[model samples]
Target: MENDAETEKEKKNKNNKVIVGSIICTLLVIYLGMATYFRTHFYFGTEINCVNVSAKTIKEAAKQMTSQMESYKLSLKEKSGKTEQITSTEINLKLSSNDEFKRLKDKQGSFNWIFGALDSKNSKLKANIIYSNKLLQEKINNLSCLDSKNIIEPKNPSFKYSSTGYVVLNEVNGNKIDKDVLYKNIVNALSTGTTTLNLDSTNCYLKPKYTVKSKKTSEIKNILNKYVSSKIIYTFGDKKEVIDGSKINKWLNVDDNYEVVFDNSILTKYMRKLFSNYETIGKTRNFVTTSGNTISIGGGDYGWDINSSEDIQKLIDDIKNGRTVTREPIYLQTAASHSSDDIGNTYVEIDMVNQHLWFYKKGSLVTQGDVVTGNMSLNTSTPAGVYRLKYKERNATLKGEGYASPVNFWMPFNGGIGIHDASWRSSFGGNIYLTSGSHGCVNAPYYLAQTLYNNIDAGTPVVCYY
Candidate 1:
């Protein structure tokens, strides 16, 4: 009974060994069959040139790749959100078949086909793409973005004057194409057999040199605001001339490079306007003489004269520093008062019509005398205008074209004309000036000339009018 049981066990063990051997043989045959298949056909999950070629033979894969290349169209997504296309037919694109597929298959051996099937295998085979360069360039040039009429040019960020102050202008996102970059990306897409190309993603659009987010934009904005924020109050006696942002804004500008610039010519023009308005010298003045007659006297060099160039430089500095202050402009010359009448109370008034003179000190007549002005017959009549006293001298010899005379006191007001005590004149005043008068000199009595020379100060206005 033991021998029979042992024999049954041996037979059962042999049957089990045969069953295991048959299963091994079936798996080995299947593995060998798949390896053989992969020698000609691509493994599963294989891709070439971004095109799926899994389970396809080389001929089939090449045909499929050629068909895809024939049907290939690159879609360009523009910055303007517009979609455009460049087809293989337009560019005459073709896939020049090479040994790249065979080489790739050899590199990815059939023995490793199991691993390749298990994992994804993305193989890049340089398909040796060929196309007419001229045709491709023509297609690129014909794109909508490349059209001059359809393209909107990009604008750099700038500054604009608003109701309150300067504000930053936003940059313009234009549809202008960077042709070189676009062409390169297109060639790359064609070489890789890519279907869609985002022009925006490739930065193919021409960008503004300075955008609103650029640091230079913010710097220029701050600089312009600082320039316009200045407040300058010019005090002209009781009158106040204010220079604030409204006026300064006109002088400020942003240059092409996003830099702040001041228009110096405009500032100079503004200073010239101020000179025209405030300058008193040679301006027409309405004056009331001792005779109570309001007369218009226009010629004189005795009032305000502004130094415009110096003041313009100072104003530029002030605006740059953003300074706010009250001050007067630089003056080449100034008057006694900024009132309607620049000549104050103390002055020398000569009445040429009456041939008389009156020296007033603080609105009071310090001295009065009859005077011989000029020889009207000789056309040397004393000029009629307001002037300033040049100087006072004593024991001066007055020389002229025809005569030389000695004087006790000399007070010259106008050029070569003066108030002097002339002993040559026995009498004074009246139409003696019409015929035989002192040559353009106020021939005063010795007492009157001495009093004026002693009491009057230099630069005092000498009012001589007919």
Candidate 2:
């Protein structure tokens, strides 16, 4: 009985050993079979170039890639909200077979197939893509964005004058494409097996030379604002002429290079008009004489004469510096006052009709006397006009075409004409000038000539009229 029991136990142990050996043999065979299969086929969950090639043989992966390329189409998104397409057929695009798939499968290795299957195997494969360059360029050229009729050229930023001041204007972006960049992007898309190409994202469009955010654009805007900020007040006596942004903006502009430009000629025109309106020289004026008779006087080298060139340059500099100035323009000539009656009450008055002379200093009567003027018989009557005192001299000789007279006090106002004492003449004034007169001079008494020569200065207005 004991021998039989021991034989049973031995038989049970042998049966268990044989069952475990068969299970090990089966697992080994399956592992070896899968390892050999992975040598030619991609590991599970394998991906190449964004396409899944899991559990596929090299031939199978190549066929799948070729199939995808046949129907490949790239969508180009434009700035104009328009969509354009480039198909594989249009560019004659095809997948050129290479050993890259075999290399990828070898890199995974049969033994590491479990790791690849358990985890996602994602990779990028360099595709040998073949396409006709000429055909691709032709297709790109035929795009609607490249069409002349459909293309809207881009415009650079600019400066516009407004009520406030000069302001910077934004640029206009249009549907113009950069052909060279577009061509390169399309080839890149084909090489990577990409389906869509965004033209805007790829910077495939032509850009404006200057945008509102550009450094040069901002700089020019700052310059323009500074120029318009100038406030210049031109003073003429009690009157004020204001020049501010409204006027300055008219002269401001921007060039093609986004730089500030000013039209100097426009400012020149304004200056000329201002000068014409305000200048008193050579203009008719009203004068009240000592005899209480009002008279009209004209034709004189006196009163305001603007120095336009110097003042214009000064105005430009002031505006550039953004200066606020209240001043008067430079003048080559000026008068006692900037009024209709520019000649104040300080002058010498000679009345040819009355044949008398009077001198006023600061509205006060300085001297008065009877005087003999030009000889009417000789037609050398002292010309009637306005003039200034050239100079004063003592013990001077007055010479003419036929006569030379010596004088004690000589005050010359016009050429060859002056107020001087005539030692040869015993009497003066009245109609003595009708037949005999001391040339075209005011033949005054020694006392009157002495008073005038002592009180008068150069540039003192000498008014001679009938």
Candidate 3:
């Protein structure tokens, strides 16, 4: 009985051992299944193993790598198919980080979580892949310094081109920088020492200057010289006129046979030059008057009927009586004196050389007459010196001569050889006085002498000089 009981106990112990082994085996299987599920679920759903990435992941990794590139310098070997060189001073990148696995992993979770659940082998593999992607993208972005437009790209990507040939990349369309604004900014930057850049192949714009010439300087000099050297002389008669040195026939360089008319071109030029500044005084005309058949007066003198002795007696009596008779004195005017009322007296000056007579009243020239002086001879010539009008007569004649029915102002110039009335003479100009025709009297045209006689009193001053 004891032997049998010991054997039963050993059997029972074996069964117990077998049952425990089976239960342990089932539990191990369950645990293995659960661990496998968790590993597969986490690895496939949440854990990103960059080492075993697809093409999509690689591309995303590349973009993320490019995003991290900073500013850098670059140079182009050719421009527009030419062997010209271009350089970019500073450039920056703005890349998409979606393609880069390293950037994705770095942004996905903390380093502890990224490698914590990963096996050592997988962790190292993923790190190598992510690092490789980062390096590759960086190089690609740097090499892509020229964008699709073939322009040098910059960081921050403004639409402005730098002097160093760098263009801003990724800017909005139509957002180019203004040239003036860019130039101003460059100048400011240089002056303020904010940035340094080489300005090669730049054009400078400038405004062109112009010069002007003056013409009045020379013209004014000539006008002033003419004004300083000119003189003016005016003569009055039936019509007013001016005579100067230039108008003298002997003074002109012309042939002797050329009988120059008063209306010749040279004469006109001379007249214009002489009276360039003369102001008009007054004009007088020749007219005729008759006081019976004994006298006929016209122009500057009175005609005497030298064949009648009765006419001569009447002329002498009239002269002696007219000196005592009083009449209103005629007045003249001038610019300087304004009127002849203050001076109240007229003076006559006859110039034989110029054949002109100047009448002065109130210290100014009131009238100028063209006169025919006496013949230049010892017996019949009129004396030239200061004299006064002595007498006047309406009818006059010389003894044993025909009657001079009207005689005008008679001035005893030189012992009865003065200026008086003459109505019968025709030739008034030129050397008509060479013939000894007058009875020692300056025979003026009858009307002129009459007018002078009517206008002046017996004591009016008359100055005759060459």
Q: Write the per-residue lDDT of candidate 1 for residues 1-466, one digit (tens) a residue.
A: 9999999999999999999999999988988988898888887878877888998888898889888888888998877778899999998898776477887777777766777756544344556888999999888878877889998988898678876777787888777888899899999999888888999888888889988888888888788888888888887778778888888988887777666788888978887997667778877888888889999887867788888888888888999989998899889887778888988888888899999899999989899999999899989898888888888988999998888888889988888998999887789998899999878988998888989999998889888888
Name the candidate that leads on lDDT.
1
Q: After TM-score superposition, what is the CA distance of residue 402 in candidate 2 from its true location, in Å?
A: 19
Global CA lDDT computed for model 2: 0.84
Listed in order, each prediction's TM-score against the native is 0.73, 0.60, 0.24
Query: Which tens-of-lDDT digit does each residue in 315-384 have in candidate 3?
Result: 2233323222222111122222122211133566565555555555545666454556665663545555
Give Cα-based local distance difference scores for all models.
Answer: 0.85, 0.84, 0.38
Which parts of model 3 have CA positions greater than 4 angstroms off?
Answer: 1-345, 363-368, 399-409
Native-structure RMSD, model 1: 5.1
| For every candidate, C-alpha RMSD to the true structure in Å | 5.1, 7.4, 30.8
Error of 3 at 253 (Å): 76
Q: Over the stretch 74-165, how does candidate 2's per-residue lDDT look in tens digits?
A: 88888877888989888888867658888777778886766775654423466688889899888887888888999888888878878776
How far out, in Å, is residue 396 in model 2?
Answer: 13
Off by over 4 Å in 2: 1-28, 44-49, 53-67, 95-112, 115-123, 130-142, 146-184, 202-230, 248-272, 280-303, 316-324, 341-466
User: Best-fitting candidate, measured by TM-score?
Assistant: 1
Q: Which ten residues in a row have the lowest lDDT in candidate 1?
A: 117-126
